[model samples]
Target: MTVTAADTVPAATLEPPTGRLSPLQQWWVLTTRGLLKVFRNGEFIFAFVSPALLAICFYLPLREAVAQVATIDYAQYLMPVIMLQSAAFVASSASMRAAVDGQEGVHTRFRVMPMPTAVPFLARAATNFVLLLVALACGLITCLIMGWRPVPEEYGGGVTGAAIAVLLVAMIGMALTLCADGIGLVAKSPEATSQLVAFPTLILGMLSTGFIPLNQFPEWIQGFVEYQPISQVTKAMRDAIGGILDWQRFEPTLWWTLGLFAVAAVLLVLGTRKAAR
Candidate 1:
């Protein structure tokens, strides 16, 4: 062949077109991809169904039992835990999705792409966030159907109490899904991720003060029940819903949230480094 510049240069050395997407645009594209995957997988439907199921399964059976034991309305008392469970559902789903991606070499492909490392991570987070909102909405509807109402008077009116309650629920969701996503990256497979995510959620949720009152638990275990992260978060949510937000009531939850965020950051660093390799 005759020697020429084009002939001498390899295709790999060609520069990208000027029309290439910016980081933000790339993020949006990836986010759309993730969201589509979630939709095709029926995660949105699960997000709605999970909270409704949790509310119905727990409320119908235990309403009478709870009423007999305490003066509180069962629906109102159960609302916080229902919200928390919705958050857990988001986390579990995120974990499985991330694991599936890892197993299918999606992560490896992404690593070789021109996008930043954080793009895929953030896109996955955004997808999980949308699912979390749906889960929370379903939980809210279920609670309303079950007679759970927020008292505006508790937080000086203007929806402040309801806003705080929603904020707390969102915080819980973000912390959990981030941590679970990172765990999924590290897990061997979707099956392993499922077990890992479910175990803590089940244990902490069942053993917490969410379903039962503190006094109902045995004295020996009461201390743990009172101070556990789930219980603390539930209590804070309850207080916010009840229009009783205060430093004393919210301190434990705040501290626990910060701690969970720290853990999530560490796990994300590890997960990204592992993927990079």
Candidate 2:
């Protein structure tokens, strides 16, 4: 029991447990990790490629045909829908990411961690926001290359209008991403998530006025086509870019986006609770 100097352990002073990360810091770390995952999985590449493909597919074959019927510039007319399509792509990716996280128990792990309950969801939202921006940028570039211009003659929105158009896209895109992410959290698998996301996106995008003028649609379903969320949001962005955005033009889109935000919030809460279980 003779304690030698060598055996004398200094009173093992414990460094205070490292301070917990602030919510912002926690969100940033999670967001960075999510972005890295997105890049490695090649979603980043698709963010660029998908829009380009969409532009070519729609603008090349249909441009001439569209011109024969409507006196509008196909590229200009098609830009808003294309932008919305890019948002849909982002939403699909968000859905898959959330599904994968849930399937792999990432959310469950977060539930046990010493962070706010909302951090993980917020981080996912931040990651989706970045991807949405990338998708939007690619969509814009593709449209520009295909002859869509931000000229006053085309949209008449000028700089102010262009800014509004961007804001509208961001708003609608985030709402879509959040909603898709919520669905994804409860999805059984990424495959299922993709199917869930694709069906509505296809139905909405194809039926909307993005590819053609509303007047061109058959008289039967034009009312549904006009009032649907996709068409309304697309019209808002188009008019904003054209510098003609007004309460009358934007009211429906605003309502739709708000409704989507509320739905997404509820779904996310349920999803988080499900993950905790």
Backbone Cα, N, C clashes tallied per candidate? 0, 3
For model 2, residues 174-257, the per-residue Cα lDDT tens digits are: 998999999998888899999999999899888888788888899998999999988998888878878788999999999999
TM-score of each: 0.92, 0.94
Worst 10 residues of 2 by lDDT: 6-15
Tens digits of per-residue lDDT for model 1 on 1-277? 5798987888867867567788899899989999899899998888878878887789999999999998888888898899889899999999998999999889888999988888999899889898888888988888888898877583432267877988898997899899999999988889999999999989999999999899999999999999998999888887776777799998888888888788888988887877888
Q: Provide the overall lDDT of each model, using Cα atoms, as 2-decimal numbers.
A: 0.87, 0.88
Model 2 spans with C-alpha error above 4 angstroms: 1-7, 13-19, 153-155
For candidate 2, the per-residue lDDT at 145 reads 88
Q: What TM-score does prediction 2 earn?
A: 0.94
Residue pairs clashing, model 2: 155-242, 157-242, 157-243
How many Å off is the CA of 251 in candidate 1? Answer: 1.3
Candidate 1 TM-score, true structure as reference: 0.92
Candidate 1 residue pairs that clash: none
Candidate 1 stretches with Cα past 4 Å from truth are 1-16, 152-158
